[model samples]
Target: MVVAAVLASGLLLAGPALRRRYPVAWWLLCGFPVVAFRVVHTWRPLMAGCGLAVSRRPALTVVSGLVGKGAPPPQPRVPRRGLIRPTAGGFVLLVRLLPGQVPEHFVKAAPAMAENWQVHAVRVTSWKPGIVRIVASAADPLTDPRIPKQRGPGHLLRVTVGALETGAAWVVDLRRIPHWLIVGATRSGKSTLINALVAGLAPQAVALVGIDCKGGMELSLYEPRLSALATNREQAVRLLAALVDLTLDRMTLCRVARVRNIWGLADKERPVPVVVIVDEIAELFLVASRSEKDEAHAAGTALIRLAQLGAALGVFLVVAGQRVGSDLGPGVTALRAQLGGRVCHRVADPGTAEMALGDLNPDALKAAQAIAPEQAGTAVLASGDGWERARSHLITEAEAEAVAAEYAHLTPVLSELHVEAL
Candidate 1:
């Protein structure tokens, strides 16, 4: 321990680069003994605040043994015998799994841990097979947004959202999941998320499509970047129908060329990849008038078909809704099934949270529903993997418009297809 401490101190005192390069070793050596012996016993009150430990059993001291009983035992020291890691946002309590305690036990006690640790929040995840790691944040990292860069594969999508509670940068790769479901309340930063996606994807070699059923108030400004935009039920139906036709054409093109998907085709022969963003998805199913019911159904069916088969043929979906529920109408549930990636912000009800999280640990649902108004851009996101707390960058309408104008020339003309609709 002395040697490690000496080496760590020397290296860290020597240079910043060395400290950055060997941070883990430095922190482990510099912190282990000090934290384990010096701080553990002193923080007894704070440790027990999480209700994870019991008071120490009173020892039969000489006076106690003689008197048959004594006043009481001193408080128990915390049993967190492991490493103390100073991460970006706060500290990580990493310990080997105890005999009867699982990672869930710590996770279940996160709220208390956060309060006792005097942190903004806390999350517990299994670092490895037999390790439990509790990450606590001194400040809410989501409050500080992260701007995404326009780089990555033409087909592969990566959007830099917010940071994790551990202060690690959070990004979602749409190529891996192919589609996403974003559920949030009206002021829950759904528009900001779409802006982030557009900002990142505009400069890439892909086509952007928008279905802004809210009278195009959300996405019409990006007309310079979007290959197509649908604002009403009739327009949406025609636009989705055209996309369906385009998807079928791509499939036939792939078969004729003896390839499986768009990626398998030679770059020169491939068509432009497509990413469709649907804002206020509930509007498509709201059929206000009896005369428009058929159009609404057709639009929903076409959109569902796109979700079902678009991924393999160089297409992706980013569907957002204020409230995603069965009450939205028929086919809502089926359409949701295709969305492998899920992002949930502060929802008005528990069911919206449930639809976004879907059988995830109940903790995630609770977390989503519990999102306070102070954290507008923050959200709970789940994909094929697990979930994380994320936030979209503050890309306003003006910034998005500038980006669209900058990349407007790159927007290709689809002469063969009806450009007015799709």
Candidate 2:
């Protein structure tokens, strides 16, 4: 005991003083007493003490769950009707609720259950009360082959995000949702995913336009397909006004046909869906203070109107940004209402992540941040259908170029009237 006490005292007294002077020697010396004490006694306390010391600093927690023996795994339970089997990182619940039985009931349950698990659900069947075949949650979104691989084979030539499974093929039936909100920190694969969407939709006959406030870096590569590219305040205003006009024309088309939604009508009668992709939304609000309020007001209102009514008129907006707080102004709040699909990547601040994903799945924000920087192409995706922690497929510049080359042959010749739709 005396020898142990003296050795520990020497370590405590000399370790810090010597560390900065000679880290190697200090570490070597520190290990002797540490190993000796651990050898003679249960090592838990010493390790715990060191951990507590380290935790005092401002760093991400290095330790995860306890390493000790844990409770025995739960006994395998028969899946109840409307409940699916839980996987390694998520739960799969089947629902027996019919289309109208309880729609929001499932949607509202996410924020409540998101604290413990990520959730996803797809309707399979509701023929019986105790038997629903819904896929509630998945460990990762990209892991499923059924979700979709691309929008179309030779379309959005650039795929900076997720892609179709290697052997599996599927197309996203966008008749489901009208608008999507994409958020991520810079270089977190936001633009990449958008490329994938474009590549997916490129083969389909659709009008493509882009509002790139940071010059045209994100969309300029596909200038051949982009009908219009907005780089600044004046251009954004013009571009949005053009979109409003197009929306009105489409509305006129819908009103004339007395149709509520495009999909509700015959495919031949429906107008081709127009997609608008906006990058760096914060720049719209980040103009000089001296800028005229009228311009800001016009821009804000146009975006909000698009967010609110564009969906029903066969217009979809894919808005991306770093932050969506009060810093960006009031327009974002209004726009949030219309964006039903949410995807979030890592953010520098938790508050930013919260703002982007809180409405859909609070847990997703943290999951997005938790994704390692090395895993750059991954993100957390949440939609009206369900939530999925997915890895956005890495669309390299080379791959985008390749896809663009292939789809160039299929690019539709834009009509003169389609010029304004850009």
Compare the candidates by lDDT and give the number of the best one.
Answer: 1
Please write out the lDDT profile of model 2 over residues 33-110, one tens digit for every residue: 443333235223322332211133222222222224443332222222332343332234454442334434444434
| Cα displacement (Å) at residue 75, model 1 | 13
Candidate 1 lDDT over 308-416, as tens digits, reads 8898898899999899888877678888888888889998888888877866556678778879977888888876556788877778888989989999987866643
Alpha-carbon local distance difference test for all models: 0.75, 0.60
Runs of candidate 1 with Cα error greater than 4 angstroms are 1-82, 127-129, 146-156, 289-291, 416-422
Worst 10 residues of 1 by lDDT: 30-39
Which residue pairs collide, candidate 1? none
Ten consecutive residues with minimal summed lDDT in candidate 2?
A: 163-172
Model 2 CA deviation exceeding 4 Å by range: 1-173, 264-269, 409-422
